[model samples]
Target chain A: MTNIAEKLNISEKLIATLELEKNSLAGTAHIQAIRKTALGSFTEQGLPHRKNEEYKYSPVSALFKSELCPAKQNACAKLTKSTIAELRIPGLDSHLITVVNGFVSEDLSDYNPNAKSVLVYNTRNTAKHAPALFEKHFGQYASNDADAFIALNTAAFQDVLFIQIADNVQVDKPVVILNVTTTETASLASPRNLIHVGQNASVQIIELYVSIDQNASAINNSVSEIVIETGAKALFYKIQDDCPGLNLITTTQASQKANSHFDTHTVTLSGSWIRNNLNILLEGEHCESHLNGLFILNDSQHVDNHTLVDHAKPHCESNQLYKGLLDDKSSGVFNGKIFVRRDAQKTNAYQSSKNMLLSDDAAINAKPQLEIYADDVKCSHGSSTGQIDEEALFYLKSRGIGSESAKALLMLAFTQDVVNTIRIDALRKHAETLIEKRLSK
Target chain B: MLSIKNLKAGIADKEILKGFNLEVKAGEVHAIMGPNGSGKSTLASVLAGREDYAVTEGAVQFNGKDLLDLSPEDRAREGLFLAFQYPVEIPGVSNINFLKTAIAEIRKYRGLPPMEAKDFLKLVKEKQALVELQVTLANRSVNEGFSGGEKKRNEIFQMAVLEPCLAILDETDSGLDIDALRIVANGVNKLRSENRSFVVITHYQRLLEYIVPDFVHVMYDGKIVKSGPKELALELEAKGYDWIKKELGDVIEA
Candidate 1:
């Protein structure tokens, strides 16, 4: 750790841990050069403080201020195929990849590795297996220059789940990356994932975070970079239903080429403290993007969702809708930023953030920022925050529905629009079930 | 079947219904005709256990039970229905789903098992046909994007399905055209029976021409000033409410 960054409150314990991991990490010379550059950035710019606008609502760096990072540790013992079988989420008909802690445990996963439509590699082996491809896209879009967490994450790792879709071949099933964290102590996990879709190929990716034990204390600093080629389409779903003891800061960045369609739905069900940074860049013309998110929180849980849609090309359209239902003392934040470049004329952008604070103590902060240099563009944004509609609740109760059920119906209705944006029927049903389970409680 | 004694209710600090009293027996339809701001809607809201209205000095009894003690859903379970003047539009909740849930809950409260799917569908079909409601409309979100006539007709359709014993129509005829008023009155007329009663509150006597009321009461300044037979409606319609207000004016002051 550099002396200047120490003034930024980066813990001394964290600095020592990173330096130890930096010496022990093994990678190719080219990948090492990338890590060295990331380490240099991390040394210069430490963890973010409250002064940073992005980290204003969430003090995620506070978790690392006192204790060593948990990403590289927390290897669960006795996680055999039989022991981990109970951790698998059933009923998802997709190619599954299970990453226990930060390691891709093949014994606990179910996927066909020999499939010609795609190539999948674990992080530890990617440096030796797909050195050329890994050197090109890994760390390209999710630049760690400004983000301290990304800088530290890009430098420290045990494994990176790498997936590459072949050109002109449509994958038959979605690739499900299920991150299961199990540790005895308060562990930290950093799972860096990279996905690249070739030209004319279409694929679906579902990243699920789960904790085997609800009482296990852990924090995950995860980042995934996706690059979509021309004429390709992709559907990405990020579902966070971890335990209360597990906190998370996950960043997903994607860049799309010409004529490509990308849709992402982020559903945060349960967690301790979660901060999600989702950024998408329309690098080519005629690209379309849909960003939808739904988060239902209770107790003292906190979740901050920040998204960016950069329309760098002409004729690109994007729509964002994020809805949060907060009960008890839980708090939530939604910050959406849209940037339309000077040449990106004919761009259409719409954003809306709606929140329902069930309790008076519960709070929400919603911000919609738009910057457009183009003259001929249509952009609109609005935000609404309030309690459940008492009139609607009374209307339901007058029809013989109980108060709890009435509230549930209204709450479910509030999240219906964003939930309906999910294209996959089964996944949508799964999301509905997850939301229903929370509301019913 | 339903009785309100000295019902004085209001929203916030201002009391709207000063001293109201009414009783409706089974096999009878009571038409409460009054001008605007006469506490007609307050009586409806209070009867339905709306939390906004506080019943400061009154006792409402429904089927031998203290109605004020029950919750809104309990009042509904006790066979009390209020067709709102401005029906609320709740989006995302399908109309049919809402009805099914209401029916299931009401049935459960009555110690009855869940209704068979076929029977529920049949009941829905029958009630929809009675109100001339489209199947698509019945299956859409509850009263969402519904016209004035359709919303009124939907209230009657729900009343028919739930079979409420004492139904309160709070200005259900305020914004309806002639054809819509006819259809709504037709639906209500079909649902009337010897065991069911209705409190049809309206500002216009034109609605009574279709479904004649057994008793007509004129409400003024939160009190029932006059009570008479159904002809009283025609008399009030012919000679405006000024005559009654003038006569009752002396009595009110004294």
Candidate 2:
């Protein structure tokens, strides 16, 4: 991989850009050491080459050709209330946190006043206002060695988000985190988020990405670190529907303690290139974790979802189900790994990834792997890729449905399993509406 | 209500319905009985506009319109229904939602306003009981994990819900037990009206005991070889299909 990276030499310009941004990137003196460590790691690793096992399907090295300027301060000051209203989920009452050009906008956000124990703040404010809380959990869950992108985001992100739910507090409403990217020219933004759910606390978070300028060619590299403490229950949803010119790479790492329940749902609607890495670590006994993803690609779009569920303790259960619908010349890749360590006895893990190709030119590649070192563990993984069921289509169409509507209904039903995992009714309905619209086109 | 004139249809290169002719009037029930390869199911499929069977040379008129020219869904919208011997199992699609969509599409084709949600649910309740389908099964994926009896009963349930002008049952009692057969037959009998017609295709005369047909036709090879009153079903059941085959041996050998 290093030899291939040396041959490509695509990291020289990126390294130079990093060096220039190093002096300008703002952070307190306490965070400076963490930043230096991350930068050192990224400098050694450079851009991820195709030879790297984690990025074999998504070639991040090729996207390094353009020299992107870092996002400037106050990039979305012109955004008005009407734009935010258009993006809101109808009938869903939520606490909105807006991130524009990787910058947090407090003015355009709606904080839950009734939930006084829940604190939401950007990284800078967290560092200034809640230094102890920020220092204890910010960089603990996400490691720099996992991926160079996480290291890059840790080192160079201009803005980082921090969400904290107090122990024993049950949030009545969901928290909607809207990440909007807008740029006048080709630029790069790395948004880092650290979320902590205290003992026995329950909360739901939805992340939606929106782009203002479709032709600006923006690159967003984001990292989210979540910590679910003992007895905590958390649901995290990530919905990505960015512009065609954007390159999105997000790595979400969550650590669950004893008896904790954590689940993540990711739905990628459309993007030129998207690579989402979701990792869950079950450290204590009796922990439950689930990861469900749906990616629909068309018109030369490409998406790759790589998931890992690590069972490190006894009596843990984890399940993963990811589906893809590829049409036109689009392609999709799903690589899921479930690992049961030597001490993780009585562990049960099931993983399945299914794909449906709608056109002759559409394609999908799936790799579902299970590695169980423990003899007492039950682990299995399966993957299937094929075209839509012809008999199912005929069954639907013979009942008075038009051909187009029949096709759309089948596609919707195929994705309905993952969509049903969303506990929020309005959010699930909104996702269905978007899926229906995409299928019609 | 339905007419087939010298219809010639087949799958691939082999012809199944060779110059078949049939005429069914309103408020009439016709039963077609035959041996295993007598094209019993093919006739039902051809009437339902299945694309796999090509009408090489045929004319089918349903209520004054050319049924062959319409698509399968259009045929369905035109009040034509076929109760499949093997109901398709579509996972992830709820039975209620499927019926709702089908009813909505049919209503649209007829230029009727969309049915109200209350009325639709009421109709579902009324029709589901006709086939003795449980509420849980109605809420589940269409025919998924359903027992053989449940699947056949669900087919009748769907037919009852659609309320087509012309209904064709293709061996609905193939795998059904005695109780399921009674329930399904009773459901079909309840849907029988003055304006509706039926063509029941089966091999046994046992089903005819429940939903008695007005006419019983013995089809040998491709076309009808014998036509008689309801007593014909009992006679054929007692003597078996050898009587018809022996009578039609010269025609088949030709």
Best by TM-score: 1
Each candidate structure's count of clashing pairs: 4, 0
True contacts kept of each: 0.86, 0.61
Per-residue C-alpha lDDT of model 2 across residues A1-441, encoded as one tens digit per residue: 665645345456556677777766666665776777888888888777777988887777546655666666556555787788888888899999988777777777888634667888675654556547778887888888779888888777876788889999998899999987777766777888889999999999999988777334568888989999999999999998655566788899999999999988999997788899999999999999999999998988889999989999999999899999999999889999888999999999999999999999997889888888999988888998888787777777778877888888888889999998899999999998998888888
Tens-digit lDDT string for candidate 1 (B52-99): 998899888889999999999999998999998888999999888899
lDDT of 1 at B192: 86
Clashing residue pairs found in predicted model 1 = A70-A188, A71-A188, A71-A189, A123-A160
| TM-score between candidate 2 and the true structure | 0.94
User: Per-residue lDDT tens digits of candidate 1, residues A1-441?
Assistant: 443355454444566677777766766676677778887787776677667898888875546533546454445666567754554445657888888777777777889988878888885765676647777888899988858878877876667788889898798888888887766655567788899898999999988888766224566778899999999999999998755556788889899999998999999998888889999999999999999999999998899999999999999999999999999999999999999999999999999999999999899999999999999999999999999999999999998999999999999999999998888777888888878898999
Q: Pick the candidate with the highest DockQ.
A: 1
TM-score of every model versus the real structure: 0.96, 0.94
Q: Over 4 Å off in model 1, which ranges? A: A1-10, A69-90, A214-217, B135-139, B250-254
